[model samples]
Target: MATKSLASCIFCKIIKGEIPSFKLIETETSYSFLDIGPVAKGHALVIPKYHAAKLHDLPDEYFADTLSVAKKIAIAQGLENYNILQNNGRIAHQEVDHVHFHVIPKPAASDEEGLVVGWPAKKPEMSELKALHEELLEKLG
Candidate 1:
């Protein structure tokens, strides 16, 4: 569970205007701010104005608007490609409890910066894969 953590979270301060931010864009539903401690050159975080611990906690309308705002920021910022990342639980590396989307601009295959994704190879057998897929579908439903 996400307790109210306004005491030390920088993101909370950004929402409250207690700290300054290099905000690139803002909307009625969301706000896009540059990450001062960034992983890439144009690293930014898009967040809903209303505090929510996770993405799923937000209303569908708000989620859709957040994506739209993110796309606008990407275009205005000259980001040809980008990634939208939202973490949920603490085990998923969610440092901040508020609902935020990481808008990491994909480098032009030259800067060699952006979200690096990889996983150890574990080729599951066809039967195993099929069973797991079915289980996931049922769980999702």
Candidate 2:
């Protein structure tokens, strides 16, 4: 069955040509466009044509194209250091209901430019990690 698209989705509208976008590249399964509200120069977005609210909701077939397109955009722009970001839920910073990847270029050493992230690393018990790994492995099987 074909995946149903939300007509109200902004990305869907862009895909349908209803909305204008600064298109960078387009493939059979994905679309790439320059971000209008860029955090840095050469900031772009790559999205799968198949509309899904979250990454887990998307099919495996659509995965390769999205990453490939993102790679092409980064290569074409000569981005040496950059970030490929994807958010799932609203609380995780996903503003759009459609799954998309952000290709943010970190051109300079200034924190003011590009993606700035705070890594709050925590030390957990090795036993906890081992238990979680076993649970995940069993689930995978």
lDDT winner:
2
Pairs in clash, predicted candidate 2: none
What ranges in model 2 sit over 4 Å off? 1-3
lDDT of 1 by residue, 1-141 (tens): 222445566676786678899978776777789988677888888987767788777766678878888788788779877888889999988988888888888876655788776568998899999999999999999
Residue 59 in candidate 2 has what lDDT?
91
Give me the candidate number with maximum TM-score.
Answer: 2
Candidate 2, residues 1-141, lDDT tens digits: the string is: 355579999999998889999999988889889999999999999999999999999999999989999999999999999999999998999999999999999998889999999899999999999999999999999
- Local error of candidate 1 at 3, Å? 16
- Whole-model Cα lDDT of every candidate shown, in order: 0.79, 0.94
Supply every candidate's count of residue pairs whose N, Cα or C atoms clash at under 3 angstroms: 0, 0
